[model samples]
Target: MNSDCVFCSLLRDEGAADWIWRGQGASALLPLEDGRLAPGHTLVIADQHAVGVQDVSPAALTQVILLVQQVSVALRDAFGARGVNVLNASGPDSDQSVDHLHFHVVPRWAADGLDTWPGGRSGHRLGTQWPAELRRAVTARQL
Candidate 1:
């Protein structure tokens, strides 16, 4: 574990907030923030330290996402949230505040005033011109 990472410290020390769940590959808990960003705002983090998605094994990432799904359901039931927003900031240029990989599961409701995505925008863009080999490489690879 990285001695400098707060998440690592939280896990290793064991005096952190109440854990929602914990298992072989992932753990869930309320974020250690000044206050909840939204009702039932929780974090699902990989048990092993990894800076981003690319840094983790597929099995580990799968475990984390599965836990996120479970926690989202729990939030929906416990908080009566209409829906939830599963967010991850995976890289240096991303809005990730912590180095360790984690996903924010924020409960949402109508007019929650939480603009997780940019508002006042009509549409978004996707790159049509792309590297054909990128698709080929992924599809051709064996597990």
Candidate 2:
């Protein structure tokens, strides 16, 4: 675990965390941030410190994803959520705030007023046939 990571400290210091579930690979909890966007805005964090999802091993990533699924269900039921959103930011360009790998499991309702879009959102809307370039790139990259 990285000593500089807040999630690592929370893992080491149980009293500082409010857990939905803690396990070998990951833990789910309410975020420590102030003025949460929505009720039951939970964070599913990796137990081992990894800067981004790409840095995590498949096994550990699987564990985190499973826990995210479990937590999403719980939060949905608990909060009577009409819908759910599971979000992640992987790299600096993606605007990942923390260095540790984590996903936001947000319980949502209609007109909840939570803005999930990143800052400086583009005004351009994707026309149906316009994304053919994206498809071509995916094919060229063999992704």
Candidate 3:
């Protein structure tokens, strides 16, 4: 466990973060910054200390995904949510604040002001052609 990682302490049950579900390789908790998002907004955290999905073991990732699915269903049924948003940020550019990998499961309702596509303003430029190097990278599977 990383000594400075708060998620590691949460996994060790050493923190005050309230757990909604706990598994061998994953756990679910209400995010400290949440309660304003939706009625059932929660975070599914990987049991292992990993910066992102690419850094976690396959077994642990599978466990985390399964828990995410379970929580999504719970949010829908328990909170009467019409839909759910399963979000994850992998790096600083993606707004990942915690070092450990986690999935944010947020319930969605019709009148909620949550914007599903926060980057919707960029849609107008979608018709622009991809750079040659980027096209080659995709074709060569370099990314």
Candidate 4:
């Protein structure tokens, strides 16, 4: 485990945080940030100290995905969210503040006022602007 990682400490003391759910290899904790995004925004994280998705073991990655899905479903059921956004920032360039691998399950409503798009005025739509080759390169099949 990374001694400097805050998530590792959180996992060690699960009760210290606002945990929505905790599984053997992963857990869903309530967002520490101000709840501007959504009421049930959660951080689904691996218990192990994986710096990024590429560093995670297959079993650990599976557990984190399972927890993320579970938290997303719960957000929909409990908070009346129409949709959910599953997001992960892997490295520094991706705006990952923490080194530990974590997924944000942000519940979405019609008028949540959060800009899901990172490119504010690029006028880029997902399937429209992305080149076919670039899309293929980033697609889940490559992973």
Q: Give the TM-score of candidate 4.
A: 0.79
- For residue 97, model 3's alpha carbon misses the true position, in angstroms, by 0.7
> Against the correct fold, how does model 3 do in TM-score?
0.81
The positional error of residue 94 in candidate 3, measured at the CA in angstroms, is 1.9
TM-score per candidate, chains pooled: 0.83, 0.78, 0.81, 0.79
Per-residue lDDT over 1-143 for candidate 2, one digit per residue giving the tens place of the 0 to 100 score: 98888889899983577787879899987887793568788999999899998798878899999998888888777878878888999988777889899999888898988777667866779878868988887688652
lDDT of each: 0.84, 0.85, 0.85, 0.83
**Candidate 2: which pairs clash?**
none
- Looking at candidate 1, the ten consecutive residues that score lowest on lDDT are 121-130
Residue 143 shift from truth in candidate 3, angstroms: 15
Itemize residue pairs with steric clashes in candidate 1.
none
**lDDT comparing candidate 2 with the true structure:** 0.85
Ranking by TM-score: 1, 3, 4, 2
Backbone clashes for every candidate come to 0, 0, 0, 0
Candidate 1 lDDT tens digits, 43-124: 8998899998879889999999999999888887887887998888998977789999899999999998888875576466
Error of 2 at 67 (Å): 0.9
